[model samples]
Target: MARQKDAFYFDGFRRSADYACQAAKLLSEVMHDFNPDQLRERMDGMHALEKAADGVRHAMMDELVTAFITPFDREDIDELGRVLDDVTDSIEGVLNRMYYDNVTDM
Candidate 1:
């Protein structure tokens, strides 16, 4: 199951990092396998990771809005959350394009 929404800023980042790692690993496996038929399935899995990362980011923003005392500036927190999610989103993007563009091989 998906991880619980981050309760703290550090948790959000750690969750995002985990999602990014999962995406990277999934993408690596896809490339190593080099199967066109499986591209769609791979894309689906990548998207799930990206979506999970997004959830943590969104939760982080929600917390930031209500948090009065933070370790850093609001902008920094928001930026970090965005950057963290981007790692997974970026990996998903690669798979997305490959699937849509009908890429037959690596």
Candidate 2:
């Protein structure tokens, strides 16, 4: 049998998940090596990652809006994307709090 291509946009969802994992990892590293002095620089890096992830989600959504047939339910796909974005946002929130509080010790 010939291999079938992924009809659903599962790869996009997977990519978003991967981004969330990376953001979480970065958050852990920042906390482990907490350096108030470098907080701004570290945040810049995190923002870049977040922005890239957002780009992926947006592109997916744009495609989804015009897709006639999707692999999964549209609601589920949208929710998945939103949740992934939330994870990244939450991690950034924690880092933001730490930075604002001048948390020097992990």
Candidate 3:
């Protein structure tokens, strides 16, 4: 039972990482087709993906904190969750900076 729970938690972390990667891909595509008019829409899509990733990360963290017998160190699980969230945040920061800087070219 503990192994199964650990697997489930790991799976959730993997899914969140996947979502962050997908969001980064979408941002890359948008950057390739840079246009001020479409920036908001593109950013919106990226934000949605980031939110989804964050949701999964938060769920994992909550489970880790609540579980009396986590398969791994609780701190490690929390750190991994934070890293997954930071991936999206880093991407978002780049996009936001570009938008604010008035960068019209890719």
Give each model a TM-score.
0.90, 0.88, 0.90
The residue-by-residue lDDT of candidate 1 on 13-106, one tens digit each, is: 8989999999999989998888998888788788788888888899888888987777777899899999998888888998888888988967
Say which prediction, candidate 1 or candidate 3, comes out ahead on lDDT: 1
lDDT of 3: 0.83
* Model 3 lDDT per residue over 1-106, tens place: 4577788688988897898788788878877877888888887888888888888887897888778888888888888889888998888878878878887777
Where in model 1 is the C-alpha error above 4 Å? 1-7
Q: What pairs collide in candidate 3? A: none
lDDT for each of the candidates? 0.84, 0.82, 0.83
Residue 101, candidate 3: alpha-carbon lDDT: 87
Q: Give me the displacement of residue 39 in model 3, in angstroms.
A: 0.4
Candidate 2 per-residue lDDT over residues 8-102, each given as its tens digit: 36777788888889989999898788778888998988888898889889988887899777776889889988899889888888888888887
- Ten-residue stretch with the least lDDT total in model 1: 1-10
Q: What CA RMSD would candidate 1 show?
A: 4.9
Cα lDDT of candidate 1 equals 0.84
